[model samples]
Target: MIGRRILLAAGVLFGAAAFAQAQIDNGLPGPQPLDAGSMILNRTLFEGIMDRNSKVRSASAKPMPAGGYLSYRASSKVRQKVTREYLARAEKAYGKPIAEGLRKTLGAIDFVATWRRLATRDGLRTGDLGDSVTAYWAVNWLVANGKENSAPGQMQALRRQLGPLMASNPGVRRMSEAARQEVAESLMLDTVVLAIGADTAVQKNDPAVLAKLRTTTNDRFKQAFGIDLTTVTLTNRGLAKR
Candidate 1:
């Protein structure tokens, strides 16, 4: 079910730098203060924590223990680099006008609203970022149509449009090719998880399709986070609760 997928993905992100921000953004409401060790506990939110852990364990150098959210001081540096690199690349590839638009517009708001707003805006309708703008349109479409669980093809279409669009931006491309790689990686994971959940919910309520996808849907929980699906809970039950 969509609910299960959201839980699993959310669980997978439990301890990353953006996890707390995501939690609040997802409507959890209110911040829960974290003690120092609590940050370490969040390492599972990230996959490379193990690599950090191995280094900490074997080397005489004492790096912070892994497995916490943004607690690794390194992530702060990494995130800044990403934003700066992307901005610089975007500025160069897109030119001053479009780059400023992206920074002032796209960067200013949350993802969902940004996409939807772009789709409706006249000024954003044109430019080097057109493909990215269209990609967001597609995202908003899939989400609004409730085909969130449709298939990979939907996401593929968005990728197809946005990938080249992103590439076309010299500023964005100036950063190593890895910048696009990172965005694609994170987006793919996020989309697949959410789509699976939406698709599950749709199929779940359908008698015939439900039977076929029930097992597949059940396993999506683990597929998303590697954790038992039953253990995690969602406050919103998959959809934004009314």
Candidate 2:
């Protein structure tokens, strides 16, 4: 179930592939917040301490162990580098910040740390840095290709289209409210990204380009999680303005 959620979360942002051919793997590696010593302790517990200590609201909180603190700092530096590298690559590929809004959104999210905490709490592995990077690039792709302008409308159209799919899937309906919401949002985001890519292809009258974009998007999602969006029933026409 958690696996499904992760895949859905990832798939939601898959349409960011409309940018140039650069891959997310070209970005820096995922953060390694746990050193050899810290690995001996429960990751959740250690993550809790790190989270509490790192926050401004928790200024009065006790500090993490020296090793944990050092690991956090190291991981943070690497994460920032990954973001910088991704943006630089996008800038070079496109003449400007494509998807500037999306890039800003991604920058605002400390996804590495957030995913680390979430995965640790859920007993999942935490090393899929490429997934997060792909998501960023996907958005960057959208921004670069001018798809960001239509993203909100596309997102809403997708939600309306997905309503029936969500209702029909008992497994989705059975999820906890928070999990369900997350899945819904992720799915919508993925749909929006795909719609933008498809729209770009249509505008350019390039079916081959569309095929490549779809292939790349699916490949990235598959790399992160085994799910493939091509098989999903959601349609690009769903993104059309009503």
- Put down candidate 1 lDDT per residue, 120-195, tens digits, no spaces: 2322221222233233334323433333332322333333323333344444545333433334222322333233
C-alpha lDDT values of all predictions:
0.31, 0.34
Candidate 1 TM-score, true structure as reference: 0.27
Consecutive 10-residue window with the lowest summed lDDT within model 2: 63-72
| Shift in Å, residue 136, candidate 2 | 13
Q: Write the per-residue lDDT of candidate 2 for residues 1-242, one digit (tens) a residue.
A: 01111222333233243332223223212122212112113334423433432342222222222121111122444445545555554555553545453365455444444444322332222332222222332332343233323222222223233233333444533444333223322322333334434444545667566456556655654344333344332122221111
- My TM-score estimates for the predictions, one after another, are 0.27, 0.29
Scanning candidate 1 in windows of ten residues, the lowest lDDT window is 233-242
Q: Which residue runs of candidate 1 sit more than 4 Å off their true CA positions?
A: 1-140, 148-164, 203-242
- The reply for model 2, stretches above 4 Å from the true place, is 2-74, 113-122, 127-213, 218-242
